[model samples]
Target: MKQLFVLATALLLAVSCSQNKAPKTLVLYYSQTNTTKAVAEEIANALGADLEAILPVVPYDGDMGATAARCAKDAAEGKLPELKPFTVDVAAYDVIFLGYPIWMGTYAPPVAAALEAVNLDGKKVVPFCTFGSGGLDTSVKDLQAKLPNTEILPGYGVRTARIDAAKAEVDYFLKSNGFLAGEVTPLPDFSEVRPATEADAAIFDAAVGTYPMIHAAATEVASRAVPGGIEYLFTAKDLPRDPAVEIPDHFIKVYVLAEDGKEPVFTQVLR
Candidate 1:
């Protein structure tokens, strides 16, 4: 009976330990050149999360010319490309990492399709992108507009040329966003600030009109100085805008200025 009691206690301890383990994650990525796909796999393996591939219902051309043509047409028409069927039980995980390659200065259409098809109301979303030159291109901003009430963390982008070399950055990003099971690191506050000009306001207004969930706005109209440049104060609002100011090509860039008029505090390009 004593031996039986010892076994029961040991089993109980094991169960408790297992129950306290870090939550699992889900990695969803859409890649054309396989760079983003490779990164997604690495992150999933590192975090012990399930891997999901987001494919479009309409296939994309692997060649640059055809793909570019298709993407351009879609953008011009404001179309949300359809995605292959994907299902996720909202309660299965604590975090979802959405990965994609930057296409035409924004999130890939297939990724948008995937997000639209599924619901991510209460999940923490971490977006990672691979870009050739334009860097992150407004993926986080665009996502915030589309998905409201979701905790969409700031994204990380690696140059396509340096993708294989981005392991450290990828690890840091995952750790920073609370996706990987580890001690959480502090992040700089990234609240959206209002723009200074009517042009800026129009650009943000267009984005809000499109997504309408991020609560982005034009908060302050004044500018501040930082180390190298000026920081502009603005409110981030999520709402529709007048069609007159909705031109996509000429939206204002987002930036943070130093209070002392020394340099730019920080910056993110918004559309």
Candidate 2:
């Protein structure tokens, strides 16, 4: 019965190999000013996942005003900028960490193009974003709506002001989500933030009617600086809050170009 024994041993080895195969993961992202890229790198390193950046065929201008104007036009028109050739076997990866900087309450346009390029019908999608005062909940919902066939995990967001503590935040997120087995680190705290001042109100007022996306009148609540611009967080005075939602102070972020001589031309509006 030596042949029978050999066959059984081979079958057991095959089963063991199948069971022990490492889960393949990919970290795909599009970063405008390296903020999202930094977060993506941290997640990729923690999970030992392959990393890929989505590059647009035409590089955006370094001037914050110019880039903002272009992005606004493209986004309004539903035009996806042509992307540089990025080939990834999407089906091979069991998990994909999709990252982007928040643009107008949604993921960047390049992210939209990337998601449309691949068929992730059965894969797990974990979305993460970099923002000023904006939260990740809205963007995660947008992604879920776009790829309803895929499973989306709870996402993570990092404010540019808190980039120094991203590793800790990412660690906590990973451990909490059962993606890692290790000691959890404390999440970043921004509770000591000061209230918005009259200067902040003036900035919002100056750019009120500049962009189509931003409401004509708003009450400035907070503000923060991103890489290429400053985001003025505000709440519409006319809009009623949904009592069903727990977040009472939910604010929208209006991005303005950071360069001098710019009349605070509004670029992006994000919730």
- Using lDDT as the measure, the top candidate is 2
Cα misplacement distance, residue 262 of candidate 2 (Å)? 34
lDDT of 2 by residue, 1-271 (tens): 9999999999999999999997799999999999999999999999988999999999774566787788888878988889887777767899999999877667878899988788889899999988754547788888889998999998888766558768976988899888889865443332233455677667666765434344334554545554344555454443334446454344565544333555554434455
lDDT of 1 at 17: 94
Clashes by residue pair, model 2: 105-270
lDDT, model 2: 0.75
Q: Which regions of candidate 1 deviate over 4 angstroms?
A: 1-21, 76-78, 87-91, 135-137, 176-178, 181-271
Kindly give the number of clashing pairs for every candidate.
24, 1
**In terms of TM-score, which candidate is strongest?**
2
- Model 2, position 209: C-alpha lDDT score: 47
Q: CA lDDT of 202 in candidate 1?
A: 56
